[model samples]
Target: MPEYQIFKNIQKHISLSDSERQLFISLVVEKDIAKKEIVLEQGSISRKLYFVEFGSLRAFNVNEEGRESTIMFAVQDWWITDMNSFINQKPALLSIETLEVSRLIEFDFSTLEELYKRLPKFERFFRIIFQNAYIREQLRVLDKISFTTEQQYTRFVEKYPQIVQKVTQKQIASYLGVTPEFLSAVKKK
Candidate 1:
C-alpha cells in the first residue's frame, strides 16, 4: 500500500508505531471518485469519513427553495464528512460531492470505532481535528457578521488561495453568502 499522506496527516497530531500505522491503514479503503459525484446525499445516513488524497469536494445543503448553501470544501490532505451524521449514525443534513476526479481514503464508522478501541491515540487525533474544524467555523461565522462582503472575499482568498484556484467563482460566492454577480462586481472593483 502507498502509505504516506494519511500517516503524515496523523503524525501531526499523534505518533503511531509501524504496527499501529499498518493496522489503521488496513482498516481504510481507498476510492477514486468521479467529478460531480455525490458521495453522500442529504437525508441519507453517512457511514464513512473521507480523507482527500488528491482533488477537492464540497458539502452543501439545499433549502425548501432548492437553493444550495455551501457548508464547506475539502481538498488534498483534508477530511470531509457530515459530522453530525457520522457521529450519530443518523441521516445527513449536508450532501457531499466531488468537485474534481478525486482520490480519497475512507474510514467506515464501525472501523473507526474498532480502531479507537485498539489504538487509543487516534481518539486524540480525531478530537483535535474536530476541535480545529469547530474553531474555523466559529471564526467564519464571526467574519460573516463583522466584515463587509469585499472584506470577506479578500479574507477567503487570503486564507484558501489553493481552494480559490480549484473551485468556481459561483462556488466561492455560495461559500461567502453572495451572488455570483456580486462576487464578479467585487472582483471588478
Candidate 2:
C-alpha cells in the first residue's frame, strides 16, 4: 500500500513497529466516492469508520417536517462514522454523504477487532480516538446550549473554514442552527 494520510494520522497517536504498521495497512481498503453519494444512509448499519484522504463529507438527518439538520462534517485527514451503529452493529439515524468527490480509507470493524487482539497498542490507539470523539461531542453540545449564535458561527468558521467554504450557504446555516437569512446578516456584519 502506498503511503496515505491514515498512516500519518495513526502515527501521530501511537507508535507502531514496521511489521505492525504493515499489518494495519493491509487491513485498510480505499474507495473513491463521488459528490452526493450516500455512503451510510439512515437505517443502515455502519460497518466501517472512514478516514478522509481528500475532499469532504457531511453527516445529517431529516426530521418529520423534512428538514435536514447537519450533524458533522469531515474533511481531509478527519475520520467520520456513525459511532453507535459501527459499535453496536445497529441501524444508524444519520446519513453520511460526500460533499465532493473524495478518497477515503475504511476500517472494517471485524478487522479492527483482530488488530486489537493481535496488537495491544492498537487498543490504546482506538481508546484515545474514541475518548477524544466523545469529548468533542460533549463540548459541542455545551457550545450549542450556551453560546450565542454569533459565537457559535465565529467558532465554526474559525475551526472549519474549509467546510464552510465547500458547503452551500443553506447547509452552513442548518449546521449553525440559524436561518439562511440570519446567517447572511451575520456575515454582513
Candidate 3:
C-alpha cells in the first residue's frame, strides 16, 4: 500500500506496533482528488480529516459578498480540515478544496473514534497533532497583529515555500488578509 506517507506522519509523535499500524491502514480510505474539487463545503457537517499524500489543498471561507478568506494551506504530508466542524460534527465554517490533483488519506470521525478505542496511543498522537495545529494558528494570528503586510508575506513564504509554489497570488493574499493587488506590490518590493 502507498500508505507509508501517512505512517511516517503518524510516527512523528507516536510509535505504532505492527498490528496497530495494520489496523490504522485498514481504517483509512485513500482517495484520488482532482484539482479544484471541494471536499468539504461551508454549511455542511464536516465528518472527515484529510491528509495530503501529495499535492495541495486550501481551506477558506466565503462571505456574503462572495469574497474568499483563506484560512490555511496544506501541502504534502499536511493535514487539513474544518477543525471546529469536524470535532463537533457541526456545519463547516470553511470549505476545503484541492489546489492540484491530489492523493489523500481520509479518516472518518467514526473511524477515528474506533481507532482511539482500540489503540489508546492514537489519542496521544491526535492530541499532539491538534496542539501543534493550534500553536501554528496562534502564531499566525500573532503575525497578523504584530507584523507589517510585507513582513507577513515574508514569513508566510519562509514558512510555506512549497505552498507558495502551488497556489496563486490571489490565494496567498487571501491567506494573508490582503488583496491580490496589494500582494503584487508586496512582491515587487
Candidate 4:
C-alpha cells in the first residue's frame, strides 16, 4: 500500500483540505528497514515520527541489568517513535527496532513544525492522535498494575490478536513485564 493511504487512514477522523494533505505528504519520507535494524537507539535524539506501513517494530528500554523491557509495539497501520525524545528534543530513553522487515513513513520534527505552521488544521489532527495514544498508554499502565500475568495475557490477546502471532514470545513477555518462561506457562494453561 502507498504511504499516502496510510496517512489518509490516520486522517480519517480529521478534516484536511487538499492543500493540507499535499503539505503533510511533502513532509514525510518513506523508507524501508530490515528486521532487527535499529530505527532509534537509546541516548540518541529521536528526530522522526514513524508511521508503520508494513511489518512490526518494538520499542524497549534497557534496565541496569541490561534486560530489555518492551514499551510498545507497532505493526501495519500503526505509529511508532520515542515520544519523549521526539517532543523534548532530548536523548531517547527507549530504543525502537524493527521486528520484521518494514516500510515506514518518517516525518522529521522540523518538517512537522513547518507543516503545523503552514496548515494549522493539522495541529488538531495530531492533537487528537496524541490524546488517544496517551489514553491508551495510561490504560496499559493500569492494566499492568492491576492485572495478573494470565489476565494481562488474556487482555493482550483480546486487544491485539494479530500481534500474538506476529510477535515473538520473548517480546510479548517483555511487553507484559514477565519472563519468557512465565509467558509460556501462561499460554499452556
Local distance difference test scores for all models = 0.92, 0.89, 0.92, 0.88
Backbone clash pairs in model 1 (N, Cα, C under 3 Å; residues 3+ apart or in different chains), count: 0
Off by over 4 Å in 3: 1-3
Among all windows of ten consecutive residues in candidate 4, which has the lowest summed lDDT?
A: 1-10
- Tens-digit lDDT track for model 4 on 81-118? 99989999999999999988999989899888887898
Report how far residue 66 has shifted in candidate 4, in Å: 1.0
lDDT, residue 135, candidate 1: 97
Tens digit per residue, CA lDDT, model 1, 99-151: 99999999898988888999988899999999999999999999999999999
146 Cα displacement, candidate 3 (Å): 0.3
User: Between which residue pairs do clashes occur in model 3?
Assistant: none
lDDT at residue 39 of model 4 (Cα atoms): 96
TM-score of 2: 0.94
Instruction: Give the lDDT of residue 27 in candidate 2.
Output: 78
Instruction: Show where candidate 1 strays beyond 4 Å.
Output: none
- Per-model TM values vs. the true structure: 0.97, 0.94, 0.97, 0.94
Better model by TM-score, 1 or 4?
1
Q: In candidate 4, which residue ranges exceed 4 Å CA deviation? A: 1-3
Candidate no. 3 TM-score = 0.97
